[model samples]
Each structure stands twice: as structure tokens, then as C-alpha cells.
Target: MNTSQEQAEQLFAQSSSEMQADHFDTAEALLVKALNMDPRLAEAHANLAWLLDRRGSVSEAVRHYELAIELQPDNARIHLNFGATLAELKFFHAAEAAYHKALLVDPTLPGTWCNLGALLAQNGRDDEAETMLGKALALDPAHVAAHFNLACLLLRKGRFEEGWHHLEFRDWYHPAEERLRCRRWKGQSLQDRVVLVMCEAGFGDMIQFCRYVAVLRAQGAAQVDVLSHPDLKPLLQTLDGVGDVFAMDDDTSASDWDYWVPVMSLPLYSGTRLDAIPAVIPYLQAPADRLVYWRQKIDQLSPRPGLRVGLVWHGNPAFENDAQRSLPSVQTLAPLWRVPGVQFFSLQKGNGEREVKRFQATQPMTDLAPDLKGFADTAAAIEQLDLVISVDTAVAHLAAALGKPCWLLLPAFMTDWRWLEERTDSPWYPQVMRLWRQPTGNDWAPVVAQVQAALQAWAQPVKPAN
Candidate 1:
């Protein structure tokens, strides 16, 4: 090789090593230097793009990947990387074009196919996505990422049984493998074992999966321990068959335990049938003191006794579909204001308070959340309320578990597991809950109108107590 070519190769090697070591700044500098020395260095540009993508600078990464593709338009890997980054940014159309270009250049690139499938699935093209993902798996049977992505696609399509089966392949995926290596206790038999169940995902996921604790115990697990977020710990501790429950920082490994299960997977292991779901009411109990305090607070608020309505307008902002699934507090409260003689209390938290203030300006509403703290306080308040009217949030789960009447307002394409598909009730929250699904995607107005009518009808006969 020529001197300049050899030097470029050395820089590329050194930059690759630094990137592997996670010294992104140094790697980025070296990669840029190499590119400056040889503008035709597609490998260096690709490496730098990968590093930037890993650092969460996806837009910058996309620029670099575009440059790399310009340098070597036939490079399937560069096209695939650029496509994946575009998908992350929700630039679905661009991502699709990039993935298509990659496949045209080299159809054998399974990662590109899998990602293309995922993007297709996200855009409501499930059949095509499934076909693409199947092709990816056929290309490489051991491709664990393809398996996991396919599982997600199937889950999105509401094929839970097959979905969960393929989801087990997540252990072989890169990021999931690192997370799964945490200290886990495994036992031959569950009968005498103290199984520690850990919460792996979001608050809604924890709530959805908490239903499995009893199923695990019934499956011959002698004792069940749960390591969950502190906010959820108090309520989860009251669950039936839960032996020990603590926050994530608690050292459950120090105690005697036989096995560990992620909360979400309990249903698969226990062979939980839809009919056999533990629908026991008040599975989660509030602390006595907290309950008494909330009761007194409600009494002081002098809320009209009949059909007390608790309202939550926002969910965690970090959730991918939060903008589509959640509503501004004022919009949520607008319909509830039309319901006469029903007391509307704010169950909203976080920045939701701003919207609550706007709603209170036009309606007679009470803020019950200011003094209310974590899930325990929320649970206590839900217990006191006659019903909870909420968006897709942990409060909805808390209310359902507490056996309070709950109206769950859902997006048109709701979360995979909610699976109502335009139904008025959720089989998951069997008792004391009704679902109000949006008729069209990103349209909350009609759903709110329905809620207004329902609440008005519900509050008709009940006069405010003297």
C-alpha cells in the first residue's frame, strides 16, 4: 500500500479500538482526522457515525452516515446504519428509503431487513414487516436481534402467545444480554424456592405484570419476593402471595431465594389463561395511615359524595407515545366540568399541574395531588374515590387494583397489551373499569366528548349532599 493509504489504515484501526473502548470523544477526533487525511475513507466515516449514534447524537450520526454512503454508495452496512438512525428519529419515510437502498445493494444484510421490518411495523404495515423479519431470520437462524424484533412486531399485532415465545430470545440480544447478566438465582424446583421477581421496564409494565405474582406462587413457588421502584413498593407489598417486597436498592440476593423472574415473563412461565387472570379486588392495599389521611383530606375538601371522580391527564413523558396517548389537563377536565354534581379531583402529577390550574380556572375542581406523594398516596386517594377517569397511566392500574370504578381513556392504536381494539371494556381490568377508546389516531376530542356524556348520565340523579 502507498504511504498515505497505510497511514489512513492505521488511523482507522486506532479509531476503531478507541470506539470499542467507549472513548467516543477520542475516537471521534481520530476518525475525523483520518477522514480529513483521506476524504474517501468510508470505513472511518461509518465508524464515527456508529460512535455518534451510540452517544445519542443521532442527527449528527445520520450526517456522517450520509457522507459515508456518498463515498461508497454500494456499501449496504452504511445504508443500514443510516436507516436505523432515521427510524429512531421517527423519519419513517426516509428510513424506509434507506433500508430499501441497503436491500437493493445487498439483500443478505439481515440487520437491515430486521430494522426495515420494525419500521414497517411501526407505520402500520405489519404484514410486510412480518415478511421482512421472517426473511431476516431465515438468512441467519442465530440472529437474536431479528428474533427479538420479530417478537416485538408480533406483540404489536396482539399475537401474545407466539410473541412471548420469541421474546425469550431477547437474552441473546446485545443490550439485553448485558442487563440479564445481573445476579439471578435459579433453582431446579420452585416448590421450596424463594423467587425474587424484579421489575424490568416501565411503571405501566410493572402494574400489568404484578398480576402474575399470585400465578407464580400457585405454580409451586413457595415464596415470592419483589424488587421494584420505591414508588411501587408500598402498593406491591400488599399483593397476595408476595412474601417480601422492597425497592430496587434492596439486597434481595442476600436473602435465601431459589430463582428470579422478570415480572413481565411470569404469565408465560405460569401458563396464565385470560379467564384465569387473578382479578381479585384490592390486591394492592394502601397504608392505614395514608388512607386515613386521604379520607380526612377528602372530607375537608367537602367533595359531593356521589360518584367521586379522580382524573389523571398525563402519563410519563419519556414514553414513546405519550403525546398521542396523553392529554393536556385542561382538555381532560373540560368534559368532566359538564358533569353536574360530580366532584372532580386532580390525580395528575408532574408538569400536569400547569394544565390542572388552567382547568380549575373554568371549573369547580379540587387538587388532591399537591399533598399526595407516591403510588402509595395515589392508591390511598383512589381507594377513597368512587371512580378514576384517567389516560393510560399507572394511576389507572392502581385504581383497577384497588377495585375502584375506573374509566380508561385510550388512544386509537393503544399499547399492545391493552388490546381493546375499539372495545368499551378491558378484559385485563375485568372489574370496575371501562375503556373509552379514541375513534381515530391523535384525536382526543371525541373520546373526551364521550366521557362528558357518560359522566353527565352517571351524575344525573345524585344531588350534592347538604
Candidate 2:
């Protein structure tokens, strides 16, 4: 190598050390200097592309990625990362081509197989995804990501036996799981034993899985305590066949319980299948005081509440697919406002709450954000309404859990596995939940039109039979 090439390599080494310490800006600067010193350095271009990828500079990342691949066409790692960047940008065809190129270069790469499977799954090609993911596991059986991805695919297809088993490889164990010092529950006899159920992931997950505590109680657990999200802590106190609910922020210890298990795992241990889910409606209830408070509050807001309906159009912005899952704007739901004799209340909290104000002047839907402080408060408000219409969010789960009439709007793009393959109804919520999925990605118009038509029919008063 020439003197400039040697100097560039040194700078690249410095960038690697800086990256390990999470000095991204310093690493980026070093990488740029290195690339300047040796314009033809494929390694420098790839490294700069990666830095740009992480920082959301998509155009620059793609430019460098293309340049790197051009400089070193046979480098499998570059193609893999370039594929990932393309996938992130929703260029599925190009991403697939890139992934296939990587595999052709090096067929033994299990991670590449896993990535291809995940991308195929994301695009709704389940059969191809299954085949690709199986190859990944065949190459590397203990690959955590491959196992986890395949588990989701199987679970979505309603193949629960192996799905539940493979789901354990998610490695969801927290620091607290270790601190418990007791054996993880493996569907054992819990007669007269104290058990702690730890919450994992998000609030939607907690609400969906908390029903298992009842199954635990049925199995003769003397006390079933829940380590809950503080937001849902008070609400969970009303959950049946369960004991105390506490949050991570609370000063609690592992010594307080016997065996511990992740809340989601309750299904696996209990032999939950599609044919037999623990679908008990109204598993969660509002505190009597809050129910009464929300009832009067609703009456005051809408004096003659003809056909009461709740609406939630947005979810957490931080959610990876929020743009696809959420409606374009609050105005997107303006058609529903045209439904005669129906009163609308906003159940939307966080992120897009401000959008509610814009609709109030023209659409006149009552905004419920100011009064809702927690899940319990939201649960109480939901009880006062006849129906809830929501995007795929915690509010949908919350309403379903409460046994309220909930019409869930699901996105076509990478639909959540929990909903399973679309059938317009959910077994999770049974008779109470109706699903309205977009026909294609970012296409909410048809779904809104259908919901509006349904709402119009729904608002009509029932006539007495002769």
C-alpha cells in the first residue's frame, strides 16, 4: 500500500476505537478524513455509509454504500448493510436484490438468510419467508434472531405449538429477572405458592398478557403479584384473580415472591392455542369511583349523547412503523364526523394530541386528553362510551380488554403478529373487537370510507318488532 493508503488505514483504526466508546461524531470525522486521504478506500466508504445510516442521513448513506459496492463488488458485508439501508427506506425489491447478491457471494451467512426472511415476512410473502427463515436456523440453530423471527411468523400463521416454544429465544430477561433468585416457572404446579409476573415490552403487551394472571390463579397460585408499568398500575389493581401490582420505579425486591415469569410467557406455559385462548372479556375494570366520574363528565359534555363513540387516530411516534400504522392526519377521520346523531370523544393521548384542537373548530369532537391521567382513567372513560374506533395501539388493547365495542384500524405494512392474519375479527378480543385493515400501505381512505358507512348504519335506532 502507498503512504496515503497506510495513513488512511491508521485513521480507520482510530475511528474503530472511537466508535467502541460511542464517540460517533469523532468517528465520523475520522472516517471522512480517512476517505479524503485515500479516495479509493472501499473500507472508508463503507464505514462512512454505516455512520450516515445510523444518523438518518439516507441519501448520503446510499451514495457511499453504492460507491463502496462499486469499489469492492464481492464484499458480502457491504451488500448486507446496503440491503438493510434499502429495507429501512421501504425499497423492498432493491433490498431483496441486494440480499440475494450477498448470499450469492457467501451462501453460508445465516444472518443474511435471517434478514431476507424478515424482509420477505414484512412484505407478506409468508411461504418464502418461512423457507428462508428455516434455512437460517438449519445453518445456525442457536441463532437468537432467526429463532425469534420464525417464532413470530409461525405465531402469525396460528401455529402455536412450536411458536410458543421458539418465542422463548427472544432473550427478554431483564436485570430484575435474575434478582428474583427463584426458578423461572415452567408450567409447574403452583398450588399454595407465591408467584411474581414481570411485565415486558410495552403497555399494549401488558394489557394483552395480564389475563394470564387469572390462569395462574386457576392453577392454585396462592398470590399472583404483577410487576407492572406504573401507568397501568392502578388499573391492574382491578384485575381479577390477582394480587398487588407494583412498578419498576417502586422500591420492591425479588425476595417478596417465589417463582417469577415474564407476563407474555404465561400463554406458552398455559398451553395457549388459537382454538383456546384465555378470552375472558372485561378482565380489567375501571374503579367504581372513576366510572361514576367519567359517566357524569360525559353527560355534561354531550347533554343528549345519542350514539356515543370514542376515537384514537394516532399512536406513539417513537414506534418504528407509526407512520404506516397511524392515519395521515386528524382530518383523515373527518368523514366519521358527518355521521348523524353521533357524539365523538377523543381517546388519543400523547404524540398527536394537538391535532384534536384543529378538528374541534369544524368537526366538534370532544377532546378527552385533559382528564385522562392514567390507564385507569382511560378505562373509566371507555366504559361511558358505546364504541371505540382506534388505530392499532394500546388504546385498542385497553378497550378490547374492557369488553367495549372496539373497531381496530390496522396497517397493511408489516401488520403486527398479535392480530394474526386478517379475518376482520380478533380472537383476542372475541365478539367485542372488529378489525378494519388498510387494503395497502399508507392507504387509509378505503378503510375510513368503510368505517364511515358502518358508523352511519350503526347510529340508526333499532325498531321494535311487531
Candidate 3:
């Protein structure tokens, strides 16, 4: 090779090694020096783009990736990286174009296909997403990420079996192998083992999967212990078959449990079906004293008995689609305001004060949430209310678990596992909850209108007995 080419190759090798070591700053510096020596070095530009993307400088990464693509237009891997960066920046259309370009350059690139599938899924094109993901899996069956992503898509489409089948790939995606290892109990017989069921993921997921505890016990688990968030311990302990309950943060290594199953997988292992779902309501009960206190508080508010509605118009701000799924202010629920004799109480928490203030200005509403210190208080308040009108949030799950009626407002493209494509009822919450879905992408008006109609029906007074 020529002297300049030889020097460029050496610098590229050194920078690649540094990148692998995660010395991102050092790798970026080396890649820059190599690019200066040889402007046509496609690898250096791609490597620099990768380092910049990792550092969260997505715009800068995009510029470098575009330059690299210009230099080596046929490089499928560079196109994949560029597309992924664009997706991170929420440039979905551009990202889709980049993925398509990559596929055109090299149709058999399974990774690029998977990236394209994810972009399509995010953009609410599930059918196209599924097709691309299937293509990816056909190219490489054991591709764990493709399997996992495909499972998510299927779950969103309400295809439980396929979704769960693909979900089995989660263990492969974990960075640490130890995190994937299921706790096993060695027993003289299968019936003799004490199984500890640990809850992971979001609170809603834990609530949804907690339905399977009774099923696990039926499978002959001698004792079923539960390790979950501290907030859930008080309520979960009341569920049948839950022998012992401990906080997740608590040191459970010292506890004597033979086997452990992550909550969600219990359904898969036990071969649970939707119809066979244990429809036991009020599995979680509030403490009597707390319930009494909330009842007295509600009495003081003098809320009418016909339709005592609890309102939660917002969810956690950190949630990915919180801006779309959750309203910024309770005033957005103006339809509910017009429903006569329907009393409203705020069940929201954390940055919900502004929304409460907005509601007070426009509607005659009570703020019960300020005194609600934790999930325990929230549970107590929910027990007192006739019905809960909430966005897709932990509070809705809490209300449903306690056997209270809940009106859940869902986004067009909701969380994968809710799985109600266009239905008004949830298989997860059974009789205690009703669903109102958005008509189009992120539009809450139609859903709110539906909830208003439901509220009007609920608010009609009955005749008095002689």
C-alpha cells in the first residue's frame, strides 16, 4: 500500500481499539486525526459518528454519518448506524428513508431490516413493521433483538402467543448474563420447592402479571413468596397464595426461597390463556383504618353518591409518550365538567398541582391528592370513590386491583401489552375497568368525549323508594 494509505489504516485500527475499550474521547480524537490525514477514510468518519452518537450528540453524529455515507455509499452498516441516530433524534421520516436506502444497497442486511422494522413500529405502521421484522428473522432465526422487537409489535397488535414467544428473547438482550439467570430451587420433588415470585419492570406490568400468582400456586408451588416494590407490598400481601411479601430493595439473598420467577413470565410458563385468566377482583384490599379516614374525608367534601369520580389526567413525565397520553391540565377534561351531579376529585401526584389549580378555576373539584402521600393513601382514596377516570397510569391499575370501577383513556398507539386494538374493555382489569381509546394518533378529544358520555350515563339519579 502507499505511505498515506498505510498510515490511515494504522490510525483506524488504533481508534477502533480505543472505541472497543469505551475510551470514547480518546477514540474520537484518534479518529479525527486519521480523518485529517486521509479525508476519504470512510471507517474513520463512521467510527467518529458512532462515538458522537454514544455521547448523545445526535445532530453532530448525523453530520459525520452523512459524510461517511457520501464517501462509502454502499456501506450497509454505516447506513444502519445513521438511521438509528436519526430515530434517536425523532427524525422518523428521515430515519425510514435511510433504512430503505441501506436495504436497497444490501437487501440481506438483517440488522438494517430490524432497524427499519422498529422505525415503522414507532411510526404506527405495525403491518409494515411486522413484515420487515419477519424478513429479518428469516435472514437469521436466532437474532434475539429482532425476536424481542417482533414480540413487542405482536403484543401491541394483541397477538399474545406470538408476542410471548418472541418475548423469550429478553434474556439474550440483557447486558449482564447474571440478570437473565432465573433463580432455581432444587427440591426433593417439584411439589416441595418454595418459589419466590419477583416483580420487575413497570408498576402496571407487575399489576397485570400479579393475576398469575394463583395459577402458579395451582401448579403445586408449596409456598409462593413475593418480592416487589415497597408500595405494592401492603396490597399484594392480601392476594391468595402470596405467603410472604418483601420490598424489592430489601436483601432477599438471606431469605429461604428455592425458586424465583419474574412475574410476567409466569403466564408463559404456566400456559395461561385470556379466558382462563383468574378474574378474581378485590385481590388487593385497603387497610380498614385508611379506608375509614378517606371515607370521612369524602363525606366532608359532600360528594354525591351517584357518580363520585376520581380524575387523573396525567402520568409520570418520564414516560416516553407522556406528552400525548397524558394531558397537561385537568381543564382538558371539560366534557366531564358539564356532566351535572358528577363530583370530581384529583387522584394525580407529582407536578399534578398545576393541573389541580387549573381544574379548580373552571370546575367545582376537590383536591384529594395533596394528602395522598403514597400508593397506600392513593389506594385508600380509590376505595372510597365510585369510579376513577384516569389516563393510562399506575393509579388506574391500583383502582382496578382494588375492584373499583376505572375509566381508562388510552393513546392510539399505547403501551405494547395493553393489547386492546379497538376495544372498550381490558382483559387485564376485567369487570372493574372500561377503556376509551383515541381515534387517531395522540388525539385525546374523542376519548375525552366518550368518557363524558359515560359520565352523563353514570350521573343520572334513581327514583326514591316509598
The sequence of per-residue lDDT tens digits that candidate 3 reaches over residues 248-329 is 6676656776677777676667655655556688777776667888989988786455568898888888786687778757
Choose the strongest candidate by TM-score: 2
User: Model 1, range 1-466, lDDT digits (tens) per residue?
Assistant: 6777778878999988987897889988888888877878887888889888987888888888988998999999889988888887778899999999999999998898899887877677879989999999899887788887777776655566777777766552233324333445322457766777878777877877887788777778788888788888888888888989878666554576566777766656665454455666666788777999999888777655566888888888878678767885456557667677888788889858777676566877788778888888988888788889988888888888777889988876535444524467766777678988777667788888888888888888857999
The full ranking of all candidates by TM-score, starting with the best, is: 2, 1, 3
In model 1, which runs have C-alpha deviations exceeding 4 angstroms?
A: 1-15, 25-40, 43-63, 142-144, 156-158, 172-189, 274-276, 328-333, 357-360, 462-466
By lDDT, the better pick of 1 and 2 is 2
Number of clashing pairs per prediction, in order: 0, 0, 1
lDDT of 1 at 219: 70
Top-lDDT candidate index: 2
lDDT of each residue in 30-138, candidate 2, tens digit only: 9999999997889789988999999989999999999999999999989999999999999999999999999999999998999999999998899999999999999
At residue 105, candidate 3 shows an lDDT of 90
Model 2 residue 263 lDDT score: 87
Task: Report the Cα RMSD per candidate.
Answer: 4.0, 1.6, 3.9
* Clash tally for model 3: 1
For candidate 3, the per-residue lDDT at 91 reads 84
